[model samples]
Target: MHNEVRSVDGGSSLVQAQYIGTVNQQLPGPERVVPHETPRALRRLVGRNEQIEACLADQRVPLVVFDGLTGVGRRALARYVAEQVKDRYPGGAYYTDYATHTVDGESVISAALRSLLRRDGVRDEVMPAEPGLASLWRRRSSGAAAVLLLENVTESEQFLQLMPGGRDWLVLVAGRVESRLEVREVGGETIPVEPLDDEQAAELFRELSGLDADPDDPVVAEILGYCGGLPLALRNAATLVVVGRCPSLPELAARLRRSRAELMRSDRGPNKGNPVFEATYQEATEPAQRAYRLLGAYPAIDFTPPVFDLLIGLDEATSRDILAELVLLKVLQEEHGRYSMHPLVHDHAASLSGLDDEETHEALARVVRGFRNAAYYADAAMIGVERYRVADAPEIADPFSGDRRANGLAWFEENRRALHELLPVAEKIGLVDEIWQIAESLAAYYFDRKRQADSLSSLRHGIKAAEEAGNRAAEARLRSLASRPLTDLEQFEQAGDFVRRSIELADQDGHLVLRASVREFAGRYHDLTDQPELAQQRYRESIELNEAAGEARGEALSRMFLGQSLGDAEGLRELETAHRAFGELGDSRSAARALLITGQVRVRTGLPGGVDALTAAAEAFQTSGATFYEAQAREALHGALVVENPVEARSHLDRAIQLYRELGSPRAEKLASENDGGLDGAES
Candidate 1:
């Protein structure tokens, strides 16, 4: 009887005994674990009714593979089908885009598994390592009724890694037609999503363009033929007409014909290039054309207007106007004020840009510089200027001027995906200094967001970049910071090596602040490994070096760690001193951290006022947007109140669980599991 069912009222109850001849058993709860929301289907989906009906009718099939060419609406069809059938699966509906998750052509299965488990309330602390993730996913997903929508799947192996070990699950996979056979072998029934028919294409175009022209018009017919019935192409052609890019349908048709001729001559085959995209592109002004070409060189999937300006070396208003024009022409897509090009359009733009290697390099260099500078400034604003930043903040107009902290953090959040995508591009373009500096600037934000995997990846790139440039100080700083993520991931051996290398480099460089930072990192590594004496010794060394180097912030941080490791009255005093120092230095985030540590020690030691300290720390963390630390403070408050104040303790525990859940932290599961029985008892 591993069948524990949670009732709708949120209570565990055994099944009726009479059904099993007086044998009492609990049934598993119907858990809804929709990790990623299925993308909404197109409102004006003109001609997929048959495919949708077929998919909905086949309730017996475990896997359905929707295979088609790029931009043929495979994902749209899959999404529509999943939305229709999701209610049938009580467990949950899950969605993942393989294009965004893959690295070097292989799926990062472990990351996907972690996402699944975390959404299922599995805490990171108790979750098994990468080697055991796939088996664990199968075990946990066994017998669960669910729907999984996997988009851009390259091969069958990626599907196998995510396949649920349940008979009642429906997995909808969308990929290119070439990937259909391998998936078919894995019990996936193929459903080919083809291009629209002429009538359907006309309907969709009319819907998108809002035009009153007859479908039988020769120019309209010519334009539709040039589009080849591809939904994306149709949309582009229709958008051009709607935006008044041409005075009449005949003019648009003539433009498309001319562009088609140019494309056929330049491309490998007549059908190889999209004439709709070419015509729309050709209609753009000179600045917009240059912007489109340079944008293709931008490695990120999406970017803001400021980033576009940086890439093209234009004023903000001019860049935004260009983006608006492209968006109107459907050459670029704009969502939430972020502009992106479709894969086909991006390829066409890149191929025809005619930018020499030097121009490409220069354009990329500008982008890297912009990112590096913005990130460094944002980091300083968020964390304060006391921390040793190896990169110099140039005296430029601050993009995040008013309310620097909030704006800076918001900018980072908005651009996080693009920033991550830019790292490798920077490396490839030989922007070595920018690579390491961007990594360093992003370190605090990454840590706060609990993006350990991303942090480690960027740090590795930064390390290589630093080494290539033969910059010991930068390498040492990056290595020191790298230890944080490695330690967090429980890779102590690797963390220790990074710390050791950082220390060696710091010593050779003879920069006291750098030396102190690396020593502090060493102490953190030792503390995580439970080497208390060694940790204390390293912290003390760090404190002395920081004092000598006149780095007050570094000294305060080391003191806070020293106090936490010591876990005694003297440690409490040290924490208090560090908290005061941080307050005086205007580092509220660090002060809150110090208070959190102090509160935790007090709670563990059964000291008075521990609840008060933890409450204050939680409030500070909440206000400062330090979500991870806020969760910790809440958990600590629960610990301090669970005995005498069970009611309040449960409330705190619930809040902590919610915070951790929002963070996708593994601790959520552990905390929920530990408090489940007690909270139920408290409620009764």
Candidate 2:
């Protein structure tokens, strides 16, 4: 049932029809589909061996411009080099295609400004609507240390604007037209990609089409000559040959000449192929053209199902068919369920669309906002936000302004990866308010699930973006957000610095919510660093702030943490206070967590009620959807039960141990194991 359509043979003069294996044969489905766009390894592409040696030997290339003609594969070579020397540019990595030098033929700078914005992934800062876009682009790229690929550029101003930025950035410009671009701040050597010599052209043809295709044949030489050593031309020719359309190279040359004429006469009929692209693009329907241009608006390599609905105005089947056709024509590449235009093809399509820059921006913004909306709902469920639904609702939930605390915890777990992906786009678009909301939602998931790596990555980036955007509330939240993982990793000094920053930001912004959150996180950090008195002081302060803000849930959480820390500090009186606060919040999971900590406190003091508290907590946690807490609570209850009731103790301990083992939690297992051994020893 494989639905793969292989290229037609080069030897055939006629366009070889697609082979339908059998009329009754089933179609290839999702299970049979192979992955399409696995990023090729860096070693596989060109010009990188020298760059690698230079980077490794610490030689300075201050600026190396890889400049060339359109579709000459210069950008690909640059990308390969970037991949190779990524370690050298550790500050960051930036890629931009400068192909669209005309936004309604306004200014090359405006076109480049849009690309630069796309490159940095910067959003949310108030920017001028139009005209002076280049000034803004120049300002943003000047400071970063990264690599910039200036693709398909024409004017010197594009390079001049970017020259002031990216101290360590390597700028590679690719296109048919060169700017003779020069800068005073940095001297760069240009590596011009000349038209391939006959030998190289022949080699390219052989690689694309095979050696079996007669090299001595005049037809082969004819097609190669027509292509004029252009890599793009060679690629398209090879595709035609594989489909068995132009059997002989001479025939390809003849057909291409005919295509050129047809393209020139396009005003005569309307559907004739583009003169520049030859006749290949003319074969596409208007709907396909619309789809091609619309798909280019999404920044990410992949698109969700909803993208088809939003961007292209066709039904799913029709859109998928058009997309598949474009991929066949080599204008688009399909990967998973998503599609992307080759960067050059993307430029061509954009130029053809006639849509102005503002229109393009508006369309792109809508798509990104839609993506954010979907991911937000998913994340909301994972963090115990219950009110948000998967379908159409009256109001869109705002992570920052909305009552996110009211949503049930499930939102965070369901949309964790989606939320993670949304972070960069959210920041780039200057959605500062959204960034803060995401940080809060993610904080709960990161701590509860122990996703330390992701927590650090997401929070740190958000913090920087928030600070840059001057969103005081977001800055304050991220200050606390950055502390948790460092504390977990035993980086105490760094953890304390983050907490202090959070406090400073909160105080400057006068955000009581952020202030309270920081106080609680500081308590956690202090306890991790073995400063119990400081931890106790921070915990009480967090509780007081939450109470003053009238934030019942925050107050409850702070009370729970205070009790746990004090209980760990061997203060039993705080357990009753923690229990009361948690009960007020009506959070079964937190209440259960409180009970487990209380039981541990009681166990240290040899209190008679330890087993009862643990048993009750285990029951509550089991229904709260967390396997880890349930197992721990059960183990605690089993330990207390072991001293008085062996049968009941063994029953609970066995299940607890099995559950803990399944969850890969060694601490919970140890507790269950010790209780089991004690009961068995008592019986013996």
Model 1 global lDDT (CA atoms, 0 to 1)? 0.78
Off by over 4 Å in 2: 1-303, 307-364, 374-415, 425-433, 568-572, 634-684
What TM-score would you give candidate 1 relative to the actual structure? Answer: 0.61
Model 2 lDDT, residue 203, Cα = 72
For model 1, state the Cα shift of residue 247 in Å. 46
**Residue pairs with backbone atoms closer than 3 Å in model 1 (clashes):** 3-26, 123-666, 124-666
lDDT of each: 0.78, 0.59
lDDT of 2 by residue, 1-684 (tens): 334444557854443445545454333333311111112333453223454354345555555555554455555565665666655654455554553354674666665566556444534244455655666665765664555556545444556566535556666444332233453246766555544655666776777766444445676666665665656667667766667887666667789765532212222224334444334456567776666666554444345555656556457788677766665455654567655554344445544553344545455555545555644554554454532111232166554324443343444554466566656755655666555555655665676556677888877876776777787767777777678888767777888998998888788877676688788888888877778789889988988888898877677667766766676444546667667766775666666777777776677567767777777877886766566667666666666777778788788778777775765546555664455632210000
Give TM per candidate: 0.61, 0.48
Q: Which ten residues in a row have the lowest lDDT in candidate 1?
A: 675-684
Indicate which candidate wins on TM-score: 1
